[model samples]
Target chain A: MPKTKAVDLVVVGAGPAGMAAAVAAAEAGVEKIILLERQAELGGILPQCIHNGFGLRYFKEELTGPEYAHRFVQELKKHPGLKVKTETMVVTITPDRKVVTTSATEGLVCYQAGAVILAMGCRERPRGAINIPGTRPAGIYTAGSLQYLMNIEGFLPGRSAVILGSGDIGLIMARRLTLEGVRVKAVLELMPYSNGLNRNIVQCLEDFQIPLYLSHTVTEIFGEKRVEKVRVAPVDKDFKPIAEKGFDLSCDTLVLSVGLIPENELSLQIGVELDPATGGPVVDSFYQTTVEGIFACGNVALVHDLVDDVSTESALAGRAAAAYLKGEIKTKRWLPVKAGRNIRSIVPQRIVVGQTTPLYIRARYPERNATLHVGDGQTKQQVVSPGETIYYTLKPEDIRTADGWVEVSLEGGRVHD
Target chain B: MTELTCIVCPVGCRLKVEQGKEGLKIIGNGCRRGVAYARDEMTAPKRMLTAVVQVAGSERMLPVKTETAIPKAKIYAAMEEIKAITVSPPVMIGQVIKENLAESGVPLVATGTIAGEGCFKPLEKSLGSE
Candidate 1:
C-alpha cells in the first residue's frame, strides 16, 4: 500500500537551493511544503565541500560550505509549513505535479503539489561524457568524487594524481592533495584559459607550485587494472589533439573536473523546457519555469558561481511558488532575454515587464574594463572571466523603456565589437 | 618588483609590492583590502585547515576547521595531528577538537554538531553517479 498526500509545494533536493526554497515558501505562508533529498543528511554536497569561500554574498562573511548550509538547515527546522525528508529518493515526477518517492522509512510515497520546485543541483561530467581513449581502470574518478573520498571519507584517492580541467574543484584539489601529502603531478586544461576563479588559480595552483598546462589534454590512459600513466597532447584551435608535441607522465590516478551537468531526470519527466547553454530548465523572472505553476532555481535551472547565489535564486522561487499557491502572482505574458555579444548565456531566459530583475550572465571570453549593458542599466566591472558570474540589476526604469526583450552585451575589453 | 594577485575577492587585482628604503609600497590594488592581501602574500601566507574528525558516539565524522588560519607551512603537520584525534558525544559547533594544532597555537574547532544521543549514521556508500 502507498500513501498519497497533498502538499502546497514540493521542493526537490535539500541542497542550499531546495532548503532555502522550502523555508521561503513556509515564511510566505504556504501551509504545506515538503523538501526531498536523497542524501542521508540535509546539507547535500556541502558536507563534503568543507571549503571556506562560501556565503560571502548572502551572509556577508566567509564560511565553509557546511557552515553556509547549516544556516539555512537550522532555520528550516523552525518553519511550520515545511517538512524535510532526508534519505528520500524521488523516482518520478509527472506532468500533473505528482512527485513519487521511495524512502526506507516512508516506502512508496507520493505527494501531489500545487507547485513543484526543481533544485536537484548538478553533477560532474564523468569519463563517459567525454571521449578519452583509456583503459577501464580503477583509479579514474571525477574531481567531486575525489573530494568526497578525501574530505568526508578520510581516504586519499592515491599517492600521486594528474587532474584534467583546471576548474575550481580541480584547482582546490591540487592544493588539498598537497596538504594531505599526496603528490599532485600536474593540472591540464584543454582550453587556453582556465575556467576557475582567478583567486583559485593563484591560491590553489600558484601557491602549491603546481603546473597548470593550457590547451593540453590527456590523449590516452595506460594501465591494466589501475591507472599507471597517461599520454598528454597539445591541441589546435579547434581542440583537435596534436600528437607530435605530446608527452607522457606516470601517475596512479586520473581525476576529471571537466564540467558539470544539471541533474534533470525529474524535470524532463514533467516535460519542462531546458536551455541548451545552461543544461537546465528555462524560466522567467521569479524563477518560474515555462510550466505555469512549476518553478526551478539553483544549478537545476542554471549553474551559479556561488552557493550564496543559489540560495538567493531559490528564495525567489520559493516565495513566488507560495504566492502562486495564494493566488498573489498574476499570470502575464513573459518577454525573453538574449545574450547579444561576448555573452555566453543569461539566466531567467525571460523577464516580466515593469518589474526589477537581476540578470546573471558570463562572458564568452576573458574581459577587462568591461561594462555589461542590459537595456538602460549598466555596471562597470574591473574584469570578468568565464569562471565568475556577472550580475546585473535591471531597474524599473530600464524595464519601462521600450522593447519586449532585453539584450545583454559586453562593451570594451577586446570584444571585437 | 614582487607582484602577486590579491585573492581577497574576484577582482583579483595584480598588486605590485616594491621594497625600498622607505619600506614597502603596494600599487595596482583595487582597494585597501587588496593592499593588505599583498602584504600577507609577500610575507607569511596562512590557510584555515578544514577536515573531518571522528566522533565516538556518532557514525558520521564531525567536520572540523581551524578557528583561525594557521601558517601555510604548518598545514600538513596539522592534518597528521588531526588524523589521530576523536571526540565523544554532544560535540557543539565551534568546540575545539585539538588545541594548538601543529603547534601553531590555533585550535581545530568543530563545524558540525554531533548530538550526544540519537546519533545519525555516517554516509558509507560510495559517491553516487549523476
Candidate 2:
C-alpha cells in the first residue's frame, strides 16, 4: 500500500503540453504542483525531433524541437514551487481527481489534487491500426519510432525503404534517409493533397526526386522474415484501394506515418467526457472538462499540428486550472463551440458567456484565402483569411449578446474589401 | 499585373506584382523575405533538392541533397545530373556529389546514412540473366 500525497495541482506527462501547463499553473500562484513524466527525460518528443522549423510562431525564431523544449525546461527549473517527477507512469486517474502512478524507484504512489491537468499528449497511429495485409515483418516501423531509433538511438532502420503516408514525419524521414545514403523508393500519400506541410513536400520529397504517389496507399507488404517488397495502389475518393492499379516495388523497409491520435486513456479512466471528432476531451472555454476539477490540454485535448500551438494551449489550461483551484472562475452557462465546414474541431468546446478571452481553432483541411465567420447565425463577426489556424478575442459582453451555439464557417476564398 | 501569395508564413500575404519600366514593381509584401520572394517569383523561382544516388557495386542508393536552393529552371537539369551519378559505400555525411548541378555554384551535399550489412540487395542472378 502506498501513502497518498495531497497537492494543489497534478499534471501528467512532462511533454511540451505538460511542461507548459505545469509552469502556467505555478505562475498563477498555485503551490504544491506536481508534474509527472513517463520518460526518463522531461523534454518528451521534442528531444527526438532534431530538425528546425519549430517555435516560429511562439518564439518568433527558428529552433529545433529539442531547443524549443529546452527553453521550457529552463523556465521550469527556475520555479521552486513546481515538483517534477521523471520516469513516472500514471496508471489511472480517478473521477474525483486522484492519480495513481508507478515509478521505477518509487514503485507505486497515489496523489490527490484539487485540480488535475491532463496533458499526456498524443501517440502515432501504428501500422497495426491500418491493417495493411502483410506478413509480420521486422523492417516495418512507425515514423516516430523510427525517428527515435535513428536520431536518438543512433541506429539506421534500413538501407532501402518505401514510406507510406506523406505526413510530415514520413516526408522528413524520406529526406533523412536520402542523406544517410539510403534508398527511399517512394513516398505514397493516400490523399490528393498531402497531409504534411507544403514546405516539407518541397524540401523532403520533391527535392530528393522521391516519387510522390498521390491518391495512393500501401495495399500489401511482402516478406518472409523481413520487409522485401511492398504492393501499393491508387485509392479512390473514399480511400479504398483500386485493385487493378496495384504495383509491387522491391524494398527492405516500410515506414508508416498514418496519423496521430490523442492519448486520452487516463482521461477515459477518470470518466471525462470525450469529443469523437478530435478523439480528445470536451473542454470548455477555460480548457476545463465536464469533470469540475479536472482540466485537459495539448494533444490529450486535441492533436495540434504544431508543437508551438500545443504549448500555447497547454499554458492556458494550466493557468485556468490554477484559477479554478483559487475559485476565480464562476459561471453556469458554457456556450458550446461547434465546428463548421472545412473545420475539424475547436478546443474549449464551450465558452463561459462573460469571460473575455481569445478562442483558438485549427481547421481540419487547409483552405486558401478564406474568411472565418464566428458568432450566432443572425449576427456574425468575420475574420478574413482565417488560414489553417484562426484566433479571435471576444469580450464577455460580446458572447453574452449571442443566443446559443457559436458557429465557425469558411466564407469561400474571397478577399474582403 | 499578377498576384502571388507568400508561402513562407501562416500569414500568407498576397503580393501584387506589376511590370514596371525598370524591372518589376512589388506591393503588399509584409516583410523583407516577402519582398525577396516577390522578386524571385517574378524573375526566377528556385527550390532545394534532396534525392537518392545509386551506390556503385551495391544495390543501395545513398540519400543525397543540394546544400542550397537552385534556380527553378535548372531543377530538371539537376535531377538529370543526380540520376547519372553513383557513389561507393563508406560515404560520410556532408560528402559532396561528384558534380555540381546548380548553376548558382553550390554543390549537392550528402545528408547522412551509410551502407551496412544485411541491408537490401537486389537479387544478383537477375542482373546477369537480364
Candidate 3:
C-alpha cells in the first residue's frame, strides 16, 4: 500500500464536467486539484460522439464532440495546479468527503479533500432494464457503447439494425451506421413524439430515408448465436405493446438508446440527499450538496441533453467549491425550491434566499412556446419561451420578499402571449 | 389549399400550402427552420442515415454516417448501395465510406475509428432481410 496524498479539491470523473471543474477550481486559486477518471483516457462520452452539432450554443460554432472536448482538455492541461489520473476508479466517497479509489499503479489510495465534486456523468438504460425479452446475444448494445465500439475501437456493431429509442445518441448512431455502409432498417420510438431533438429527427432519419416508427417498440428479439431479427410492434398510450400489430424485421443488431440515468451511487453512499425527480443530489444555488463541503455538477447532478450545459454547470460547481474552501460562501439556513406543473425537476433544490446568485432549473419535458414564472405566491418574475432549462437571477430584494419557498410554473401556449 | 403538418418543432404547426402566382406559398411556420423545413418538404425531403460498416479483418464494425442529407426518394437505393460495401481497417474519422453514393451526390462518411486487426462479425439475423 502506498501513502495517500491530500488535495484541496477532489473531482471524480474526468469527462467534460470533471475537466471543466478542475480547470475552474484551479483558476479560482485552488492550489491542489486532482481529477480522477475510470477510463484509460479522458473526454468521457464525447470521444465516442463524433457528430458536429456540439458547441453551437457555447462556442457559437458547430464542432464535433471530440473537438469540443479537446478545447476543455487543452485548458485543463495548461492549468499547472490540475492533476489528472486516468484509469483510476473512485470506489467510495465517504460522508466526510474522504475519497477512496483503486488504480493499476496505485493499488489503493485515499484522499481527504476540503471540498469534493462529483461529475461521474450518466449511464444509458440497457435491454434488461427496459424488459425487452429475447435471446441474449452479442448484437444488442447501448447507443453510446456502440458508438465507442465503432468510432473508438474501430469495430462496427452490425450491418443491418433496428434502433429502439429516438434519443440523440441513438439518432446520431443511426446516421453513423448508415454512412458506414450498413443497412439501418428503422428507428423506432415508443413515444408518439420523438424524445430526440427535431433537428436530429430530420437530419438523421428523414434525410437518410430511414423509416421512423413512432409509438412502436421491440416486442421480442430472436437470435441463436447472434442477433437474427427483432419483433417490433405498436404501443398504446400507456406503452403496452400491441402484439397483433407486431412485425418482425430481419437485422443482426438492436441498439437501445432508451434514456439516461445520472450516476449518483457515490453521492448516495456519501449521505447526500437525492432528488427523486432528477435522480441526483439536491444542491444549493452554489451547487453545494446537502452535506456541506461536497459539491456536485454535470450529468451527475442531472441528465443534460447537451454536453455544453454539462461543462458550463461544472465550471460553476468548481468555482463554488473553491469559494467554500476560502470561507467566501456561508449560509445558515436555506429554503426548499419546488417544481411546478410540466417541470420534471429543478437543480439547486435548496437556495439561500439572501445569496446573490442565480438558480438554474432544467425541465424534463419539452414545453413549446411557454413562459416560466418563478417567485413566491404573490410576487412573480416571468421569462418567455422557457425551453428545457432556464436560469433566474434573484437579487437581494427578491430574496427579502420570499415567504419561505419559491414556485416555478409554466404558463402560455403557442398562441398565448 | 392543402394543410400540411410541420414536424420541425413540438408545436407541430399545420401549415397552409397552396399554389399562388408566385409559387408554393406556406404560412403558419414558427421559426426560420420551420419555413425552410416546409419549403423542403413541399419540394423535396431529405434525410441522413448512419450504420456500421464491415471492416476487413476486424471483429468490430466501423461506425459510419452520411455527411449530407440525400433525396427522400433515393434513401432506400442509397441504403442498398451502402449495405453492399465494406472497408478495410485503419479507417479514420471523416473517411469517405462511399463517394457520391447512388449518384445522389451525398458522400457516406465514417464517424469513428476502426482498428486494423479484428474479425468482422456478420450482421444480426434477427432484423429481417431487405
Interface RMSD of 1: 6.7
RMSD of candidate 2 to true structure, Å: 9.9
Model 2 misplacement above 4 A: A362-369, A376-387, A394-402, A412-417, B1-30, B37-130
lDDT of model 3 at position A44: 88
Give one digit per residue, the lDDT tens place, for model 3 in A1-417. Answer: 445678899999988899889889999999888888887656888766766667755676556676577677768767767777777889888888888899887788888889999999899998988999988987999999888877766676878999999878888889888867679999999977677766677667876789999899999999999999999999998999999989999999999999999988889899999999889999887889989999999889988767777888889899999999999987657777777765667777886767765656665444456666666322232322223346666554555344677676665633322
What is the TM-score (0 to 1) of candidate 1?
0.94
* Tens digit of per-residue lDDT, candidate 1, span A96-173: 898999988778999989999999999999998888997888899899999887776668788889999998889988
lDDT, residue B59, candidate 3: 52
Off by over 4 Å in 3: A356-369, A376-402, A412-417, B1-130
Q: After superposition, how far is residue B99 of candidate 1 from its true place, in Å?
A: 1.6
Model 3: how far is A248 from its true place, Å? Answer: 1.6
Which pairs clash (backbone N, Cα, C closer than 3 Å) in model 2?
Answer: A178-B63, A179-B111, A179-B112, A180-B112, A180-B113, A181-B62, A181-B63, A207-B50, A208-B50, A208-B51
lDDT score, candidate 1, position B53: 80
Ranking by lDDT: 1, 3, 2
Q: Candidate 2 at residue A166, lDDT?
A: 86
lDDT of 3 at A116: 95
Question: Model 3: which docking level applies?
Answer: incorrect
**TM-score per model over all chains:** 0.94, 0.79, 0.78
